[model samples]
Target: MTISTNSLMSLREYFSNQQILICFNGPISTNLIGEIGSALKEHIESNHAPELEVMDVFSVYIEMSQNIRNYATSHGFSDSESSATVVIAAAEAGHYAVCAGNLVEMGDGQALLERIHELAACDKAQLKLLYKQQLRQPHTQTPGQGAGLGLIEIARRSSQPMEASLDPLEPGRAFFSLRAII
Candidate 1:
């Protein structure tokens, strides 16, 4: 399909208004993760972002991207369903918004939303405590089979509570999006 010049310009305007530095929509793979992640790091560093902030933003991007990939692989999702949309944009107060969305089982999406809400309710101290508690528990060594530590790690790095949304796409399926402010 050919994209018209007007539509392309509109997208450019929209991205400019949003201060979006990077946007991707496609099937995510490990190699793709590294390539995009490298680009993100370079972009952030070029803007003279603080060293710590750059690391935090990059870390969150990797964790979210990996989570989407692993979940899709483990769940045996089709290529179309496994495709991911990731956006990283500049926010107020020198903060960065790292957001990712992918199709998920309806039940899984609802459960994830609930989990995010629970984490959002916790204060920094509580989150720290929970992170420690999670560490002491037995966890699988594999990617997707872990003890849910990745989300906690992302939460810890976030300057504010993470936000998530689940939009129904079809029966027994929904598009789940997660945003972490770092």
Candidate 2:
């Protein structure tokens, strides 16, 4: 299928208008993530962002991307199913927004959405206290037991509350998207 020039131009304009710095959509892997992370770091640094801000944005990007990758791996999803869309952009109030999305089972997506909501409701201090408490807890090697610490860490690093959504898709599955602002 050929992409028309007009479509490409429109897409570029949309990205520019949205303040997107970097975007990716495909099967996610550790190496791919590392490469994209390097680019993200350079982009933020080039923008003259503070060291702390750059680190925080990069951390959130890593966490969100890894979460998508891990979920797809644990669920034994196909490459198509495992494909993820991640975007990093400048956000309101000079913040950086890191968003990642992938397919998930219906139940799993709902549960994750609920968890994100719970985290979103917490104040910064509350998030920090929760992070500390989670740190003190025992580690479990159970598969798909996620979101334990990484999600909390993202919330702690974010300047604004994190957000998530579940959109219905194929039968028994949905698209799960998460956003964090740093």
Can you write out model 1's per-residue Cα lDDT over 75-124, one digit (the tens) per residue? 89888888999999999898999999999889889988998999988888
TM-score of each: 0.96, 0.97
- Whole-model Cα lDDT of every candidate shown, in order: 0.92, 0.92
Candidate 1, poorest ten consecutive residues by summed lDDT: 139-148
What C-alpha lDDT, on a 0 to 100 scale, does residue 50 get in candidate 2? 97
Residue range 12-92, candidate 2, lDDT tens digits: 999999999999999999999999999999988998999999999998899889888888999999999999999999999
Model 1 has an lDDT value of 0.92
Error of 1 at 144 (Å): 3.7
Error of 2 at 82 (Å): 0.1
Off by over 4 Å in 1: 141-143
Question: 171 in model 1: Cα distance from truth in Å?
Answer: 0.8
